[model samples]
Target: MARNQQNELQALQDTLYFIGGKWRIPIINSICNGNKRFREIERSIPGITTRMLSKELKEMEMSKLVKRTVYADTPVLIEYEPTEHCRSFGKIIQEMIKWGESHRAIVLKKRT
Candidate 1:
């Protein structure tokens, strides 16, 4: 591969290393779409266990894509929200949604 191609591939790999998973995108979308609490996120993404959610959230926080806030209330309410850095992914996510819809339609038509 050419030098430019190698550099581009590395960048893509780095991006994937951060958010490449079945759970991470949904987790991000849930929080971005206003599902702030832990239970809300878990409910939003069906089939995700509490353990998995906790683990992924910790990873995202370390990557600076998500922020966890704890409020000193009667019971210490915790909320999750996407960081400003994560806002950069909004367009990328939308493009992925568009591509997925088209790909799904194409594959389903082949099946039927």
Candidate 2:
């Protein structure tokens, strides 16, 4: 492949890897929508088990997509927030939502 094609391929691969999982994007959306606590995030995404949410959050933290914070008080509190890197992907997610809505309409129209 040409150098330009190789670069584009790598970029596409990276993006796919980032959003490859069933839970990653929804988890990111939950956090960006202000579901910071573990339980809150879990509840916000239906069909996500506690174990899956924990696993995804840990992976996202390792990938620098989220910042995990711990607070000490009467009870220890932990929260997850999207990092700037993750926030940058928000625009792409929004565009995807738009495209998905349009595609669904088209499919329904064709079916009718």
- Name the top TM-score candidate: 2
Tell me each candidate's RMSD, in Å, in order.
1.7, 1.4
> Where is the poorest 10-residue window by lDDT in model 2?
87-96
User: Each prediction's Cα lDDT score?
Assistant: 0.87, 0.90
User: Tens digits of per-residue lDDT for model 2 on 58-93?
Assistant: 999999999999998668999899998888786678
Error of 2 at 36 (Å): 0.7
Error of 1 at 47 (Å): 0.7
Candidate 2: residue 50 lDDT (0-100) = 93
Tell me the RMSD of model 1 versus the true structure: 1.7
Candidate 1: pairs in clash: none
- The regions of model 2 sitting more than 4 angstroms off are none
Worst 10 residues of 1 by lDDT: 85-94
| lDDT digits (tens) for residues 6-92 of candidate 1 | 999999999888777889888877777788899999999999999999999999899898888999999999988889877678557
- Where does candidate 1 stray beyond 4 Å? 109-112
How far off is model 2, as Cα RMSD? 1.4
